[model samples]
Target: MNFLIRTNWWKWLTMFLLTYTVVGGLLFTVPRLPILNETIRNLHFHVPMWFGMIILFAFSVFHSVKYLSSKDLVQDLFSKELINVGVLFGILGIITGMIWANFTWGEPWSNDPKQNAAAVALLIYFAYMILRGSLSDDHQKARISAIYNIFAFAVLIPLLFILPRLTDSLHPGSGGNPGFNAYDLDSNLRLVFYPAVVGWTFLGSWIAGIMIRVSLYQFKKDSE
Candidate 1:
């Protein structure tokens, strides 16, 4: 974690991959499927946003657990900032998904089970942020926020993965819908899709790292 905060290589790699994804995802040939046709290009951007969000949230929960055991304020800072960035990615994912849905599903929103579940999951995390802001003391805020972050993540997994699958969903891979794996047989898409995930995740981390550094500095300054 500390090393990533100061590293340059991964950041450079992120820029390169993102540039490639944007360029290739737009120009590259995609599988021509019924109804999907060209909108399948969204696969590069939309899916990666959620992938990055999940990764960021998982890291947030890990740091939340670390803060619980170690009682380190810095760990608490990491957890908080990670959620901040994770929520940002989640919102972007929703927006991009909506755009794709409008093109493919004939509407921006169809009350899809997974979409509702995702909205609920994000609200839970938003509540976590609100809960933190309502507190005054740093220690109390950190402790309570850490616990809430863990709980939010616990609820998040079920909301996103379990509840959505129990019913039908418009999203791929759930509710009797065949996943992209069925249509994305074109190796060309994978060439950019996989890197897009890594690139977006790294970009999120870079943003969170900046936030963490600023917050940490403020935290230390306020202590003195």
Candidate 2:
């Protein structure tokens, strides 16, 4: 037990500090601000969680392309693992956003462009997974999954970011809603936000690594 704990100490420490920093930053910063009050605390978890989710999904798409180009099973495994982690983060983001919305907007969900766009993006990736499962042949599955991943990413760009900006939204930065621009965030917020993004991303990658290792082990055992 001691050896196991020692082996994983750094990851555990990093996660602990990440949690502490996020909570501390929110507690210190949000309460003192006039406009934000208690509601601003949500920013610490919600924004970074979504940002990490997007990053993981982007990595999954990249690995899917690599697998298609090289016909490497390892890349395919990595891609699938990344997709799993990305979905987890996506769910967390949705839950956090819903909580924030309920408190701030008096509703759990609104037909905001950003919200709808994010939902569509999630559905698109979910469809990619379904497409992969429908195929039986390994090579066919890899090829089809790769193509679908690429297509999903193409749609993701406009759905999550561009379309949200183009139309009116009940959420921030749309339809004259009060929102953060480049100038709106404080330096302190940036300090925590950047680390939160990096930490969550690394954590996702760590999870993907574990999944890939487990898959490899199972494959070896089955072959033996």
Instruction: Give the whole-model CA lDDT for all candidates, comma-separated.
Output: 0.88, 0.74
Please, what is the TM-score per model? 0.96, 0.86
What does candidate 1's lDDT look like per residue over 1-224, in tens digits?
67798778999999999999999999998888888898888888988888899999999999989988998899999999999999999999999999999988999989999789878878998899899999998889999999888887887888887778788666766644445565554799889899999999999999999999999999999889
**TM-score for candidate 1, residues paired by index:** 0.96
For candidate 1, the lDDT comes to 0.88
Backbone clashes counted, model 1: 0
**Model 2 misplacement above 4 A:** 1-13, 31-36, 175-183
Indicate the residue-level lDDT of 148 in model 1.
Answer: 88
Residue range 1-224, candidate 2, lDDT tens digits: 11222266557756975887667656666434544457666776787777878888888888888888899876777777788888888888888989888987889898877788778878887888898889998778888888888788888887787778778665654654335552256776666666766677667767766777787688678668
Error of 2 at 14 (Å): 3.4
